[model samples]
Target: MASGSASLMWFRKGLRIHDNPALQYAAEGTKFLYPVFVIDPHYMEPEKNAFSLGSARAGLNRINFLLESLADLDSSLKKLGSRLLVLKGEPSEVLIRCLKEWEVEKLCFEYDTEPYYQALDFKVKNYASTAGIEVFSPVSHTLFNPTDIIQKNGGRPPLSYQSFVKLAGQPSSPLSHTLSSLPLVGDVGSCVISEVPTIKELGYVDIGQDESSPFRGGESEALKRLNEIINDKEWVATFEKPKGNPSAFLKPATTVLSPYLKFGCLSCRFFYQCLQDVYKNVKRHTSPPVSLLGQLLWRDFFYTVAFGTPNFDQMRGNRICKQIPWNDDDELLTAWRDARTGYPWIDAIMVQLRKWGWMHHLARHSVACFLTRGDLFVHWEKGRDVFERLLIDSDWAINNGNWLWLSCSSFFYQYNRIYSPISFGKKYDPNGDYIRHFLPILKDMPREYIYEPWTAPLSIQTKAKCIIGRDYPKPVVLHDSASKECRRKMAEAYALNKDLNGMVSEEDIRNLRRKLKEDPEQEAKNKRIR
Candidate 1:
């Protein structure tokens, strides 16, 4: 708080200059402010533990987007008379070293909810406290602090989206911090600020550009895209989440600002204010649970739940997740991961995900359902892992929450209402244009058989210049039978565990699995046995 002192503005999720509380805090009452980004090995390296199955926390696609964001942030800082100091190694050690070497007076950063990040932040804060350094940490990730919401709701989070909405009440007006100019950097004798590392330097091979994606990462791009949406008053006023067609390509039907949001390139509160401005100008707008603002609230809802709940990322020990015996078929999971499931609709969506590192929300729903309950009946954790590795916009809270919702593990339980991999895409895209765009192998197939390429007659397949089971793979699992079996298994599990509730432990799952495996009656009904 002393004037003419040095402060370090450590960047995490909040990669932007506008509406950044930590950055604003660090700049005020300081003669020198150092903007720093640490490329922590914790995330840059692949997690090789048993549960991870040797997947990197961030794949090339995400790393590429991150590097772009950092470069843009650095450019923005330089314009303001400072540059981002890029460092590598563990965050706590890096920050501690900077504190001593730079002779810093304050340490500031945006707060996050993931357990690993929370722990890392704690260590840094502890060190700062011991060293008698002023520390200022603020929440700018979500519209409202998850802790505040949980405290207001009797120390627990709302289970359902509607309940969450009612409990959340309404988002407050966004806070403003005006600045004519940022602090000028004084001579830091020997502190060499490294430039943002390239994708290869971050220990990943560059996958190159995705032509399917019309997205670019950074605060400038975020604002530009946001302005385009807000300027279209009619679109903003009439925006509907469910009605947006997922099959549309080249131009996303919805605002593709998710990557910006994930990296904190755009502030959620600022976005909310823009939405409000649009609503006031039009004087007519849709309500929550489906509206554009509703989408953001959903993000906060998941954060609140994830913050309060234990074992939120996994099924076994999660209190709310249903105890379904998900299959452990690596081969089936591999096919799903590589976009080779052989169902054209699902495969196309997967291909889009791999290439673009993003998919429309409805497209996400279709694939998640197919992977968990609709087709393969594989564990949702496997799907969650794949998303973590691939999605440029993947956040721990949102990713796990959506997987649980779609898998019928928690938040939802319409087990029998399966998304027909074939029909779902056809409804949005009657001509199978989405399928054809991604899966060119079946691009020439007739519209009727595009979603079900395996069903095309031999002559029809030959004429299309592609052959199923040769050029493209056959359907890994028949939709109808697999869905029915999944439903039956779910019904049985629900019936057996009707009275059970709250944080079913690993031991509990092990016992249940043992019983299910040993029982002859259960074996007779095993979906995989068929």
Candidate 2:
């Protein structure tokens, strides 16, 4: 180990320098310190992750975001007489190796919620403790820790989001957070920085146009985008509507902070701090983007739960109100995973996911519903895994919660939760603008008729210049029939524990099966035909 005095500030998902607990503590501890990022088992090879970038696959975009975030950090760190050191391996193995090159006694990094990284964290901390080194973890992922939130008369957290928001009060003595405040580096000097690789390095060929609209990285850029989004007058007033449409791309009514949030390029504190600024100080007297803050709070809430609960990435039998045996059809699952479901709206949403490693938030539900209920006889986890690998902003907590929510997991489970395929398209992409952009097969269809291409009649479907099943697959499942079948399955599954209102019991499946067997018609329907 090198003998120079250096406190290693390890960077993980939390990448920003400002208002960060790890960075703050490390800065207070040692003047001579090095920021480090381990391309370890967790970051480099997450068992599953949201993978995608524009033309850059999510795996590629993630590396790119981290690289840009690190580059920005190096610039800021140089201002602070420090530079980040990059290394690879299992975190424990790599940190042990770092001790040889630098006189490192203390390690600092943000806390995590995912089980995979948490296990790695436990190993590293134990090793550091035995080696007489100190390890510190700080909360930077969420506004309030899951432990801190008080649930109502139940171990279960609040089931509804609106209820969660009502109780999420403002933080006291709001912290000042901006990238410009970092100090200049006198001890730091010019150093070689290698460019982060694109998807090719990750062993995937690029596809389609570079749909990435030059999304910038770093805390400054995140704030810049935040300001642009929150401050736009004409658009800000009407954000809720255009936010989901494809035609409104540049003004992207949605806050495009997912990549930064994923990489922690900007702290949630900083993001919220920016909102406080816009709300309190922006002379325009705008409503402080309270509507926007609600979304960020959701981001914080998911992180809090994921971090506090182990094995949360997987489903809980108790939490989701309903779950059924999803069909095990690989071909259908693959088609959905590869963006070939053939329903133009569904395909368009998947293509955006394929092209950008992201799609608007609502699109996620629409597409997931189409897979779980519309056509594909696949398990939710199958789709969830694909989404994790491709989504640049994928967070385990949010992803799991969302998938569970959409897959008949909560109250009103499959009962009142059927998404009308036609209604959904008209509501979000009314003009078929999004479909035309991603699904070329339906490019010639009129905006009004695009949502229901199959309904256009054989003559009209042919006149629209696309042939059903040949050009685009016909609707995989009828909305009414599919919803009814899905609901029955969900109700049967919930019957597994008749005491669900109380607690679970063994052989509950047998009891549920007995109920299912009594209804022969349901048994036949239960066996999904793909």
Candidate 3:
């Protein structure tokens, strides 16, 4: 109601008010407060030449979760002697006009890990300063600040979790901030009384569930999930063998906390703290919850990498990993995309992503490895984009790092270590129970033959009621031959320019492809796999 009386708190990814720095700053600095959520159409808009915003399409799951979270946040604010002032459109545009109109004098918000947000933060900071509003960003989510984590040889950060874990333990104990929230604001900007839009309303459809949406989004739900995983410690024993099955349904038994962690519903700092508290109790009777915290450390590692770069979402920002001359085969790409790759494990994973908007982390590795390595140098961006669309928990740093690592351009550039999806399927899903779940077309085949239904005798195929060629697509490409061809091409390209930065140019890329087409051994192997 009065000049210099109110402060504007922008609610971005850090939706919950508890233990939030920005919210506390807003409450502490001013007599009144205004809270807002700006819908950046920037992410929702389709990409140049791409069918959709792959990241945003994948982002829809979080957006859907956020909508629910925001509603809950609003309710929480109401309980805490205030209410969230919701708004949508460009945040800077909205904030500039709101500051001037409401006579607000300070802006406080949580810092985001992505480059887009950092760039946006700069633009908004300029606007706020010119408007005489002080902007404040708090490091609330990550355990260690971004600059704190880097690797040996003074390289760009460690791309592998093992390296990060070793370095992470050496860091001085992480800082903890006291929790508080802003007192209620009065006479704020005219609050828009409406809910945030859904992914479908924002031009993407909901990832429908035959069951209730498994993810309960927001802070309370996130806390509940953390509790469930460690509640009585039953999950502790099962976690060591997290990737027992390959068909990728190996979830729930595996912690599903990533989505919450990605969106800041659960803070990595708090997650580790909680795990430590539980570990203290269970140290004698059981193994510590080390497996769970190890995964959380990865979240810390990626955010460290993401915050260091500009537009970390861009495929090339992880330059160490960009040297991969990914093959650009349209047909193979299509088969991989459609999930009809005749690899039941791969297909099952793909189908799950389409239906559930989530997949196991190991599944991501298998599929991404198969695509980047098996296909031989297809742009990792292609795979990254696809993951961004389907994975509910997709984060740019993790996706790009793993993609490039497998591609041999990342910090962990190992060329010979490649996953054979054929071998992976046989090993992880030995009985093919996971395969039978999704590719029901192959359900009638013998349990042993489910993965390769074509190998079943023709009579067996008839009893199963489908020919491999007619019913399910043939093996899109053979694994062993495809792998060898991929390696040869990569090696040939690297020969000219061993370094990815310039050594492997377009000319180098072309020569490798030509060599692969000419290699008879690789081609014959393809025939056998099919």
How many residue pairs clash in each candidate at the backbone level?
1, 22, 11
lDDT score, candidate 2? 0.63
Which of the two, 1 or 3, has more TM-score? 1
Clashing pairs for model 1 are 319-503
**Candidate 1 to truth, TM:** 0.93
Candidate 2: residue 503 Cα off by (Å): 5.8
Deviating ranges (above 4 Å) for candidate 3: 1-4, 42-60, 150-182, 188-193, 198-208, 211-213, 241-251, 284-290, 309-318, 375-377, 494-503, 514-517, 520-530
Off by over 4 Å in 2: 1-4, 29-31, 41-58, 79-81, 150-156, 162-168, 172-214, 233-250, 281-290, 308-310, 316-321, 373-377, 411-414, 457-464, 497-530
Query: What is each predicted model's overall lDDT from 0 to 1?
Result: 0.82, 0.63, 0.67
What tens-digit string does per-residue lDDT give for candidate 3 at 1-530? 55667888888777775567788778774678887777666654333454333333544454566677777787788877788776666777776777777787788888776766777889888888777777888777677666666534163666556666666663223336544344666664364534655555666544466522457678788888878877856455335534445454645446677777777777666777776677676744333224676666666777777566554554443344344456677767767777878877788777776556677666777788787765434667787878776666767667766666656655555566777665676776677777777778887778777777767888998998878888987787777667777777667655655554454455655665665578676566665444
lDDT of 2 by residue, 420-470 (tens): 667776775687877887787788887767987866778877787897777
Measured by C-alpha RMSD in angstroms, how accurate is candidate 1?
A: 3.1
lDDT of residue 323 for candidate 1 = 82
State the displacement of the C-alpha of residue 26, model 2, in Å, after optimal TM-score superposition: 1.7
Question: Which has the higher TM-score value, candidate number 1 or candidate number 2?
Answer: 1
All candidates: CA RMSD (Å):
3.1, 4.9, 3.8
